[model samples]
Structure formats: structure tokens, C-alpha cells
Target: MDKLKGKGKEAVGKLTGDRRKESEGKADQVKGRAKDAVDEAGDRAKGVKDSLRSDDDR
Candidate 1:
């Protein structure tokens, strides 16, 4: 969501020649990607834990 929004902002900034907006847009993209990486890592950990539990049940 943020990534897509940031991309739009960046595109608009570029089209309108706004340096501040472009910088902000770039920052937002980075922040969004960082959040996604954290979420994916957490999900992977949960999956591993669930698999281990299932194995133990057998």
C-alpha cells in the first residue's frame, strides 16, 4: 500500500519538478519495503514453529 502510494508520489514529484516530494516518496518506499521484510520474516518463523509442532504430534 505504502509502496504503491510512494511510487505514485514519486512519479508526480518527478513530473511536477518537486524535489521535496520526490525525497519523501523515496523514503516512504524504503519504509514500506522494510515493513514488508519484517512481516515476511515473522510469518516464516511462525510457519517453522507450526511445522515443528505438527512433527512432534506424530
Candidate 2:
């Protein structure tokens, strides 16, 4: 999602030779990656919790 958009912005910046845009694009990519990692962690945690609940019910 955002990662793809950031990549597009980065490519456009490089083609247009916009240093500011290029930097912003790179920042966006980093932010996107960080957010993705956080989301993955949250999902994993939820999965573990769900598993525990199911096991307790059984």
C-alpha cells in the first residue's frame, strides 16, 4: 500500500531529479516498513492470544 506509493514517489523523484522529493520518498518507505513491522507484530500477538483462548476452552 504505502510501500508501493513510496516506491513510486522515489522513482518519480529520481527521474525528475528532485532531491527533496527523493528524500521524502525514502522517508516514506522507512515509515512504511516500520509500520508494517508493527502491524505484523500485533497480528502475531493476536494469533497467540486466540490460540491460547481456544486451548483453554478445550
Candidate 3:
């Protein structure tokens, strides 16, 4: 998953002394953040769908 990969990159940055690795970690962190946002949006949409379905039942 994106989250796991992000953590791995961060760990590698700490383990190695490469500046590129550090930068890569930072980039991966950003990617992970975006992925989280997308997931939240998906959850919100699902909640709306469920609410609409319940209303239809009523």
C-alpha cells in the first residue's frame, strides 16, 4: 500500500545518508497524504450513498 511504501522510504532515508533518499522520502510522504485524502473522499461518498438508500427505504 502507499502508506507502507511511504514509511519504507522514510526509514531508508534515515538509514542511508543520501540527500536524494531524504527527498524521495518527502515525496513519498506527499503521495501518501494525497492517497489518504482520496480515501477520505471515497468514504464520504459512500456515507452519502448509504444515507440516500436509507431514505429510499423510509
> How many clashes does each candidate structure show, in the order listed?
0, 0, 0
Candidate 3 Cα deviation (angstroms), residue 42: 1.2
> Rank by lDDT, descending?
1, 2, 3
**Superposition error at 41 for model 3 (Å):** 0.7
| lDDT by residue (tens digit), candidate 1, 1-58 | 8898889889989999998888888988998999999999999998888788865575
Predicted candidate 3 versus true structure: per-residue lDDT over 1-58, tens digit per residue? 6667767777888888766777777788788899899999999998888888865576
Q: How far does residue 46 in candidate 2 sit from its true spot (Å)?
A: 0.6
lDDT of 2 by residue, 1-58 (tens): 7777888889999999998888888888998999999999999998888888865585
On the 0 to 100 scale, the lDDT of residue 18 in model 3 is: 68
lDDT assessment of candidate 2: 0.88
Best by lDDT: 1
- What 10-residue stretch in candidate 1 is worst by lDDT? 49-58
Candidate 1 deviates by what RMSD? 1.8
Model 1 residue runs over 4 Å out of place are 55-58
